[model samples]
Structures are given as structure tokens and as C-alpha cells.
Target: MSKSITITNEDILQEIKLSCKTPEIVEQIVSRKVIISAAKEAGIEVETEELQKAADLFRLINKLTSAEETWAWLEKHSLSLDDFEAIVYSSVIFGKLSQHLFTDKIEPYFFENQLDYAGVVMYEVVLNDEDLAIELFYAVKEGEMSFSDVAHKYIQDTELRRKGGYLGIVRRQDLKPEISAAVFAVTPPQLLKPIVTSKGLHLIFVEEIIQPELDNKLRNQILTNLFDEWIKQQIQPVEFVKLFELGS
Candidate 1:
């Protein structure tokens, strides 16, 4: 005879409310629980060192230095250590689940789309004067000076100029449409001609472009995103009783 695990629907609902702040958010949260449970059932466990590593990562990501400080930061956002642990555990489970499912299947897809994953490194010269911009553009094109040198000598944007006008690895999608079009059109180690946009007259240089790879790290990230979407879809049909309505 097999023993039955007896978790009531109400118990599950209350757990969801406490973890997610709303019963309507249950399915996504519960799906993480499902992953966690699956991991445990498979005799998988997150070691203390692993949890500490995750905590360290969490702290660094939020610019904190210690677990206590991380917990304090979470409290400021109305979250608790238990909540943080659950999220970390869910992340571990999700990674394990991805390794089990799509790590092999998606590697080829990742390699095929690798070019789309390139990141840009750029230098920019921003100027308010259109005529000055045109003159500077000519100077740059004629090799009178490098973009960084000109930016340092004459660009008005102090922050960018200080870094020799470096606007570091920005995704094409994140840039303004005209700017993106201009930048992507140029191959790396090449200077783009001056572009006029709403901001100002700009000259850009492509410092480098990093091609993508089909690696374990990227595969895990893709699977995590996919699972999150899947969980959201599963939860969409669920209806819930609000706390205020329950009180009423």
C-alpha cells in the first residue's frame, strides 16, 4: 500500500497567497513548486554552498555585500528570507529541469541564430551644433583624428566624453531606430559617418561585436524564460477570491 500525501487545496491556496501575495498568482508560483518538488523527488538537493553562492550572486546583483544586507533590502521591498530562498530554489530546479529537457535539443538552434546574438561596443560624439558636427564628421572620415580623441577634445556630453565617448555594449533593439539602423549597417572596427537624431549630432565607432555561442549558460536562460511563459499560460484560466472580498 502506497502512502498518500495529504495537502489540501486550501492549504495550497494559502501557500500561494503567502508566497505570491495573491491567490490569482498561484499557478506560476505553484509551477515553481512543481519543479522544486520534481527535483526533490529525483533526490536532487541544493547544497548549502550552492545556496550561499546564489545568495552572494543575489547580493552582488542588488549591490549589497552580505546576506543580512540582502535580507534587509528584501524587507524594504516587502519580501522575506524564506521568499528569497524559495526563489533561489526555484531557479535551481528550473535549471535542472532545462538540463533534463532542452539542453541538447536547443544547442543547434542557438548556434544557427548566433549572429543575432552579437553585442556592440561603441564610442559616440554628441554635439548640439549641426555645422560643428558636419565639420567633425569630415575630420573623422578624413582621418584628421579618431572619434575618441575628438570626443575627448570637443564633445559636449561630459559623462560620455570622460570615457572617451564609450557607450559600451548596447543591444541593437535598445538603441533609437535611426541610430540602430546606422550602427548595425557598419561593420566593427569601422567608423560610422555622422548621424543626426532627436538627441543631437552624433558620430559613432564600432569598437567590437561579440558573436553568440550555443553554450550551457545561454540554453539554461532560454529554457527559464520559456518555462516562465508556460507557467503564466497555465495560470491564466485560474480565478481567485480576493482578500478584500473575503473580508466583505
Candidate 2:
């Protein structure tokens, strides 16, 4: 004889539907279970002190007043305080895993490449109006007005405008190929004439270039990349069975 199952909590189904897109409670439960299991398998333990530290750091980073406010902020983002702590623990585990698995391999690979990594300071002038873009480009190129001065006057992006279009140190990989090519072509303190990207015209200034150093920081970054690749490989083959399918 087959066993019959009973549903006790109607609210669980409703909560699952509201929290997640599908009406599948089993899928949600399974997914959460998988994450919790994986976290445990990785020996990702969150100490009380670490959790408090994380809560404090989160408050400071987001400029929140208190830990309760931080919890409220997380809830606003559809996350629970427990979920936040789990994420932090998982992150620490992943970091350790990355260091353990790929530090040695990444160090040699980075050194051989000898990438010309440096800091770049730049100002961008993005205008939907082509005529205005061209006009501003010339204004900047000529001694009529400085890039910062024009950026303050005309740039639309509030964040960049406030900083006088100063884009802080960005890696070569972070920039588009065209921008990166132009930036590397010039010497320090050289102004790059306005180049048009999909966004708009960008006038770049190479403020300072710090030559690449084979330091611990670079090694950690390389290890992080390798570990990210490894994690992707690990999670690729996971299969989930929907609750409705189990009934079928």
C-alpha cells in the first residue's frame, strides 16, 4: 500500500509563492537545503565574534546607525540576518579555498604575463546630443577650458560630476579596448583627446601610472580568479527536481 501525505500549513505555500516566483515549495526547500549543506561541507563556520564583526562592518560600510538598522536594511533587500551571516561565512570559506587551491599556480602565471597594471584618473563627458559632445571635446582640447571645469559644467552623471570627472585608478581590463589602447599609448600627465564610446565622448587624463609589482596583493587577486573558475565548475552539474514533478 502507498502512504498518503498531508498538508498542515497553508501559509507555507503562500509564503513560498510570495517569496519566490514559482508556487513550488519543494524546490525552494531543496535549494536552501543544498546551500546549507554545501556551506557545512566546506566547513564554513561563523563564530559569534565574526558575526558581530560582520554586522559592525556592514553598518559602517553602508553608513547605518545600528545593527538593528542593518538587519532592517537586509530585510529591505529581501534577505534575513541569518542569510547575511551565512553569506559572510560562505565568502570566507571560498576565499580560503581559493588560496589553498590556486595560490601557487596563479603566482607564476601572473609573473610571466608581466601585465602593465596602473592607476588611471580620467574625466568623461557623456552627452546624448552629438553636437554638444563635439563642442565640449574641442573646448577641452583647446586651452579654452579645463576637462574638470567643463565636466563640472556639462556632465550629466552626478557622481562623476561632483568629483570633477575624476575616475580613480582602474585596471587595464576594467576599461574598454579602445580606451585602454589609447590610455597605454600616451605617457603620464598626457591628455587623451575625446574618444566616443557607446555612452558618449570621454576625455581621459593619465594622472599617474604605478608600474606592476609582484606583490602579495596581485597573488591574492590571481588566486581569486582561479578559485572563481573552480567554483563555477563545481556548481555547473547541479540538478534540481521541482515539487510538482515529485507528485507526478
True-vs-predicted CA distance for residue 60, candidate 1, Å: 9.4
Superposed on all Cα atoms, the candidates' RMSDs to the truth, in angstroms, are 10.0, 7.9
Candidate number of the best lDDT: 1
Taking all chains together, each candidate's TM-score versus the true structure is 0.59, 0.63
For candidate 2, write residues 30-138 as lDDT tens digits.
5445555666776766577766676667567789897678778887877876788776665555555555567679757776765545546655555666677667667
Candidate 2 — which residues are off by over 4 angstroms? 1-92, 112-116, 129-131, 214-218, 243-248
- What are the clash counts of all predictions, listed in order? 0, 0
Clashes of 2: 0
Query: Against the correct fold, how does model 1 do in TM-score?
Result: 0.59
Query: Worst ten-residue run, lDDT, model 1?
Result: 239-248
Q: Each candidate's lDDT (Cα)?
A: 0.71, 0.68
Question: Which runs of model 1 end up more than 4 angstroms from their true locations?
Answer: 1-88, 153-159, 173-177, 215-217, 235-248
Candidate 1: residue 77 lDDT (0-100): 71
